[model samples]
Target: MTTSLRSTLDFLLYDWLQAESVTSRERFVDHSRDTFDAVLDICERIAREKYAPFNRTVDTQEPHFDGEKVTLPQCTHDAQKAYAASGMLSAAQDYDIGGMQLPYTVEAAANSFFAAASVSIGSGLLTVGNANLLMVHGTELQKKVFALNEFSGRFSGTMCLSEPQAGSSLSDVATRAVPDGEGFEADPLGPRYRLKGNKMWISAGEHELTDNIIHLVLAKIPGPDGKLVPGTKGISLFIVPKKLVDTEGNLTGVRNDVALAGLNHKLGWRGTTNTLLNFGEGKYPVGGEAGAVGYLVGQPGKGLHCMFHMMNEARIGVGMAATMLGLAGYYASLDYARNRPQGRPVQGPKAAAGAAPAVVKDAAQPQVRIIEHADVKRMLLAQKAYGEGALALNLYCARLVDEMHTGEAALADDARMLLEVLTPIAKSWPSEWCLEANSLAIQIHGGYGYTRDFPVEQYWRDNRLNMIHEGTHGIQAMDLLGRKVLMEGGRGLTLLASRINATIERAIQVPALAAHANALGAALQQVGAATKAAWATGQPADALANAVPYMQAFGHTVLAWIWLDVASAALASDADQAQPSTAGRMGAMRYFFHYELPKIGAWLQVVSSRDDTCAAFPEESF
Candidate 1:
């Protein structure tokens, strides 16, 4: 039997898991269809039956900390255990690491399900994955002493970069790491130095969830003149464990100098514990002959680059989580619209009393389901376009990662450069747009969305955290303009433009997509011209002032191109059972071109504008 258009679209986009194929650019995610289906099936079942059931409970019963210990809901613990037991925690690792060896694309797709189910629970695994990335990059001794033991449940890990004084700017960080004795005294196991400073907004900072916490801390080391080095250059990474371990990696009791000063009560993501940590108190090790116990991860002065190993992965993960929550909101809204009947359509007049209704008893009524309303459909379509397109983008990036590792030298280099350039966009655009989808989902539910009665509100709250997750929208914009696009002589931007041009050329050949292709091509040219002009001006600040518009314009153009590509592929599929599915895809493509593609003109206009409007207003003027 032929499925509905929505169902067919979902199956083709996600179920087939076509984004993981890396052997050929055109044949990405082409193998193991059955394995992909099984994984997705498991995800859906776990999400519906296990994770979704406790979301409300977990949100209401946020993790609480007593003087001695922190307590979390049992369901959250159980869910984490279930996730680990299911082998999902190691899904992207090699088969030797007790992993299923699933491709990064598949892992990313599956993560969306987990995040949508429970963002808080999902966060723990993300931290673990980030730690795993460090393990891959760190020295063998570091991995064996810290990483391996942590993966085996002896220690849990957390990334510590933000301090009370330095939130986003690392150069302003004041944390100090001084050598003392054989090791230091602040170490919980004794023999480590004193780590004296305050760290803020640390996720999974203090929890009874794990035996010990491995904090990947960043601190400044003294330079040549006995003065702290300026900027990230002087900063170094330390694998500071909550409990001290011996040479054999055996864990000892008590805690390190790090103490949870307070907990942050956030507007969203209450399920994950956020803490303010004070490292090195008088009682612990500061001024006590010993310094904070620490082992450097890599060479001093290269900490930021090493941390990027984790940060890049975290950025991609943030986008995936945001997209998932958006998808959840969309599906929930769709379900509600299907079930909830509302007011009559404006086109039809009121029914006369005692007269037979114009509509049949079982037929469509003048007052149709909310899903049928034009405005509601608009919101739903917007959500679909953003969520699905972002999903495709992430998977596409993941495939690029694989290509970078396993493809030929030229292909690998191209993939690496392209992925690096798109990283900020892949992270920021979805984080922003998918959140918009969540907001629309709430609006779709009207008043019910504002209350706890529906999941849409929670989805919005969870997704809200993603804006600040890996990096803020402004930070991403700066990276895109100041660094990624402009650095290396604008090679990244040029490469991306060439790819978009290829898509446009191919799309123009398809009669169904010719208009969208033409419109997108014109917008691309406008963006390219503006970008070149900004670069020529040599005023990075002025150039970056228009970065956000470039991001949006380019994001939309790429998504339009991807939709066209999808439509082209669907049109060429076998006509047997895929015909109806292809027809639905064609309809969506038509809708996108008509409703969504037209906005490219406005985005282009904004991108091409000078920075005069923004520069005109001074800080005091605001």
Candidate 2:
């Protein structure tokens, strides 16, 4: 494993999880630093060996639809099988259910390796998130039938929410789930319904990598009038399997009514199959019906709430994916900078006034490695700040999830609240900033970074999809300022502030960190003030018009808090003096506090002023 990767995981397990008692709970009894390190090592080894080798191949030879079946590189299946056999597919599940029962924090850290190595083959992420949703909301039978298969890797899963027309606006979901009258009672999942709709942008939607594909679809169930309800209130979730399964979770070798309309060629993440799917189009009916049979997973009219369970998990997963890609790019660029010798010191005596002062031998005045140049170092440092800091923020969120799952009730409740508020920032910040880091990685690589020969370009391409994966930047921004901050009378925001302030107070005890702590405190206050000012205008349009800016400022402030925590951890480590990693942490912290923190002020200005510059402009003007 890379030093950066191991250090970050250590920081999570030791500096954060144990420190916060996230792994001290009864449920996480077997979790220790050794076990966590072991899991990370396995993930890193498998990721490097299996997934990394086929990353480029998967991207270039994306799933091909041959009118009869979809074909993928054999390596995709090989890599997936390796992952499933490693037991990470069920790493965080219960022991009775064949899980390793690792803490979510460790599981998240382990997953980052796969994301960094080959996000293309990271289809398991969705499957796990889907299984988690079923574990939370599905009945015992549903768990046995679908979730277990998914966790075992026999059946991969996907969250089927977006449609060809509805996109992220689930209220506009037009998919209908009519009750399967006579034969519905035989189904074990629940009262079965015939789902008839088309879903779009479904990743891993259809693949031959697994034996079966389970889709957790959101659709509307009709009321007494036999007419579909108009909004999300009518939405409900369903377990729609690609192949018919018996009550005992055995595949019956019968294809369901689901059909792949086609594959949507994407600009990025081409490694994973993105599909347009037609359900109940009558291509193959399970029980002489034109609609696909689906078993209800949750109550009708509560589908959005049920899906949010998966969406939120996937959102954090997306953030981690983004962060890993940024880190991957950073390491790649750093290696390139060190080896690809170029330009000399900008102030190398100006060539002695063009007198061609003795050409120093290559051995003496050898061209300095790009890393030795100030500008290249600046970009590299920026990437380190963004990549590592975003990573810390992600693991921190994962630790919060651990607390929510295992800590005391009150502490768990507080963790939930903070996660609710932080989720949007956690998702959006990395999707935005880490992509920026990838861009810097490319710049650090100069012209070669733009070429297909380098992995940095692919990293950028893969990461570009995350911005719109779980949600768009604008949507997350709206959620952050328009909802999360103000929810429960601002409890989440308050809790988050208290936590950051606690870190600030602790930092003040150390002279080296006091200045950064003060800067963060000021930034935190700016966010609070902006939060108040933005919402003061009762007009939601006015308040939300500058949501993007609010998210930017708020996200930066959150990163500042995370960086401070990281710096404190580095300082407190048992190293006799400042090790290179400690120095690197301090340097990154200084970069963020000096360069990135101040930009938040400009963003806050836009938010606090309730700037209508864009929102007030007429749509026709576009």
Candidate 3:
């Protein structure tokens, strides 16, 4: 069975947010469930028809480099073109910019469909994120010349932060951007510069899919003495297009100095190109210069600051992508379980004491479907919990983005703090847990899951990349414990606690959820204690030694709170009817609390004790 992005989105938009009256006022005016459903329906149709069919083809053929040009499946272009024309690219932007002005929550839901259908074709995510960053920080000319074209799909965008030498350590970025004297254009897109550097691991970096590629490159501006400054403090953002364009959004037909050096082959997500690009190798010099022409974005020496907006957005997008992949695998496995007959009840009549009953193609006593087994049911339930729970977490974070944009001062501040605290978990939890859900998906398919015949293996392969997407698991953990949770004098953590407490309080009002609520309450207390103990160690190294465990414990508590809220919402919708769907939700809620919440205690114990087993171990000892 195909995954119903529509049904899930409808429930989330109408049953949860509409019931909560979250997006009733402000920029969301004239937006109703019908409108949201209409947009999602379009996304579903396009994704199913254009994208899903070619997923495996893209994975198999991948992108080929013929030395001079990169070749991709025509289907990839068709899918992306369809997506671009859907108008969903600017779905969350203001109407003034040819956008739908839809709430971020609705937009995110619509995008989830595409991500689930084919993450390979879902390369538009980076373009959207890049345009969003420019919309926020780009000059008016930059918005018109670059961001607008991106919104209209005439141009594509990429974020260039990683270099061959720098890797994730942005502080060591060695790219240099020098002020252009003769090559400067007196156009509106911003100040012109000459970028001379090489960028590596640039996805969607060099593509023939669009007229031009707008690169939001991070490079350091040289000092007055022509010496390159060190570290990210000297880093600045630049709009270095693949082909230089005129102010009227027309390509000047002057090819920039950005050259596609080579392609990086990967295990998955191969539909999009990953490239090593040389900026100024004296290859394609423009205007009698040997450097790539670029325009400064925002301010010089503050590139990382502006890039964070895009990075954070990309982090959340990664979580959503992970959740959708898990959900897709879950549905596929579920269909397999319901039809793939494998075994009979272990205790049912003992197979009539026969020697395996001479297994035949069509035996009189046909085996029952695998889903009938308790263990298989447990796996399904586990997938359901992780998949749906991760979806809820992602949508919640998206809603917070909406609130931060549209809410009142105090409410917006609260939303920002809560989002900040949850960002790491939002990015990391789903990447870890949902990938585990995908593993269960493979296991559900048994032997066939390991083969190319099944999609489950591909799902697992695609999801494995997310654990390292944006940031690795360890990086997110450190950020959560060492930075975000402790920032602003712990106001973010305090705000998050209050919100979780609100959910717990609401859950306590429902007798069905009271026990889970109490469990969550106790777990929250342990998290609080763990937080204090981890910090009280005084030794930053020791306190952070078990940061990953701290992240897990904290992540579980957050998910527990989310489940409680979800259970409350489900029950709320069927308070008197006691529908089966509601009952199923309650069952999953119980499963999570019973099976998942208890694991947090041991994790938190290790965290709170400030264990330094890994930190103290000598690398040579290994």
Candidate 4:
């Protein structure tokens, strides 16, 4: 809850995004800027009071599981409770479901405080996302029994997608679900089924933080041939609870066959329990059966579609986590720079060339704060650019989510198209560059930064996971180039370019941002050209061989657009010119334009040429 963070959030929310305008919508009629401020105030206070102080405690004291149950520190428990009590878990849900009916944009802004304070202690990302999906796809009873309870915080939720064998390839998933018995269809819950399989890398898979854990699992139902259907087409979603619960949502005192096989010992996020879960292992069978009882969600073979509702939300959540972690490191390093005095500026005295009439060489000079050094400022500016630019980018996407849900039909459709193009970048860009921000944070701390004695090292380790989770960098790359940009007859990409061009036009009117705007216009053109050239052959292998590089180039271009837009907005709003908030944003924007935006050339080069040097390498040559 640094004042710096709060101010940045304020500027982004009210000034740049014009979040207050969203309250005019009928869905958000209950909310006002005052109410939004109160929510943010409470969130900042709770995060500072309960989460910030115990960040180190949770990191050092990992979750442990005894023979019978898993255990976590009391601080983690208290923090989770405090966050749930804030009514943010269902912030965007309807008022009927215990939600305050807050706008998603404000919800994302409020959640950032907790993420910055401590990401590993849990942020209700999965719980909220899971409930949101059920609200869309689940039946009436399912919504009442699971989604509502989750929103109330009586039951926490998780999305179980990856298997040990499948990993990110949902097409290769092998988890199987079968009808429970003769009366399975007539059972009060949707279509009752029995599931038996192993799910890997389940976060918060087994925890006592709530009354029960509701798992939204992806599995394939067997065909009449008694064989599991092949590929993602066969995939279907199921709701499998940790403890058997009735339609009224009361625990039946009988446990489902889902068992925690073991915990993953990770380098970071030690506070969360990432586990290998064994379903239907006979260890906790229900009613003289070994298979875990699950209720079907949506139609058979439509599980991936339903599960995507949660996956996409989690991807955005991961992006915000990465952005906040990077900001956390930036804040830490910025504080150190302000307080730690070590060096004298070299510009103090310039002796005449070859002149002996100068001050004594041994004269003692006072050491100045590290902030006095230009190189240190470079590092700080880089962090600020990446971290703050990413914050704006993510919040912009959140704002789009609001528009998509609450805006008129045409505006909502356009928002959807823009989201399809931006989601991967929003998720992957921060994951990669923000981790670099973390690295620079450590560099600013010097040798002590890498040690456990400093918190920057831990921020680096925690952020390293963002690139691999939700979706891998490579997976997102393929999604961006292989699918997203080309979806809907390339309308999504065109919609995005139109928006970027709109920002460019606005910024061109501002003299300070004119050059940056022109530079961004060129970058966007390069991205567009590379995209067309990559697909010139109309072959997946040729186009996708350089997908990662293309994604890198595309993400940088989008960020450049975001920076120019922010700068343009600040100038338009007539912000106090002398304020550090305004001046620092200009500086960070300048840094990105001069130092970072040019690197996209090399990335787009390989992309446009469809370079296959790596793809063609022989296995033994490595």
- Among all candidates shown, the one with the greatest lDDT: 4
Clashes per candidate (backbone, < 3 Å): 14, 0, 0, 0
The predicted structure with the larger lDDT, 2 or 4, is 4
Among all windows of 10 consecutive residues in model 1, the one with the lowest summed lDDT is 1-10
Residue 559 of model 1, lDDT score: 71
Candidate 4 per-residue lDDT over residues 1-622, each given as its tens digit: 2799999999999989999998889999888999999999999999999988988999999988886789999999999999889999988888887789898899999999999999889779999999999999999999999999999888999989999988998988888899998989998878899999999999999989999999999999989998988788999999999999988999999999999988999988888899999888899878888999999999999999999899999999999999999999999999998898886655436678897654433227888888888999999999999999999999999999999999999999999989888999999999999999999999999998989887999899999999999999999999999999989999999998999999988888877888998999999889989999999999999999989999999999999889888887777676556776788888899999999999999999998898999999999999
Specify the highest-TM-score model's number: 4
Q: Candidate 4 at 78: error in angstroms?
A: 0.6
Better of 3 and 4 by TM-score: 4
Q: What is every candidate's alpha-carbon RMSD to the true fold?
A: 5.1, 2.9, 3.4, 2.0
Report the C-alpha lDDT of model 2 over 1-622, residue by residue, as the tens digit. 2666877677656765463354567787676667777888888889989988888998899889998689988998889999999999999898999998787888888889899888877848889999999999999989988899889998899999999898989889889998788777566679889999999999998888888899999999888998888878889999999998888888898999999999999877877999999999999977677999889987778888989999999999999999999999999999999899986654433465658755433445658889998899899999999999998899889888888988789999999999999999889999999999999999999999999989999999999998898989999999988899989999999999999999999999998899999999999999999888997868899899999999999999999999998888888883443478788888999999998999998999989999889977999999
The reply for model 1, stretches above 4 Å from the true place, is 1-31, 123-125, 152-154, 182-194, 282-291, 348-366, 574-584
As a whole number from 0 to 100, the lDDT of residue 367 in candidate 3 is: 96
**Model 4 regions more than 4 Å off:** 347-363
- Badly placed stretches (over 4 Å) of model 3 are 1-3, 19-23, 182-187, 348-365, 576-578
TM-score of 2: 0.96
Which portions of model 2 miss their true places by more than 4 Å? 19-23, 183-186, 348-364, 574-577
Which 10 consecutive residues of model 4 have the lowest summed lDDT?
Answer: 355-364
Compute the lDDT of residue 163 as modeled in candidate 1. 91
* Global fold similarity of model 1 (TM-score): 0.89
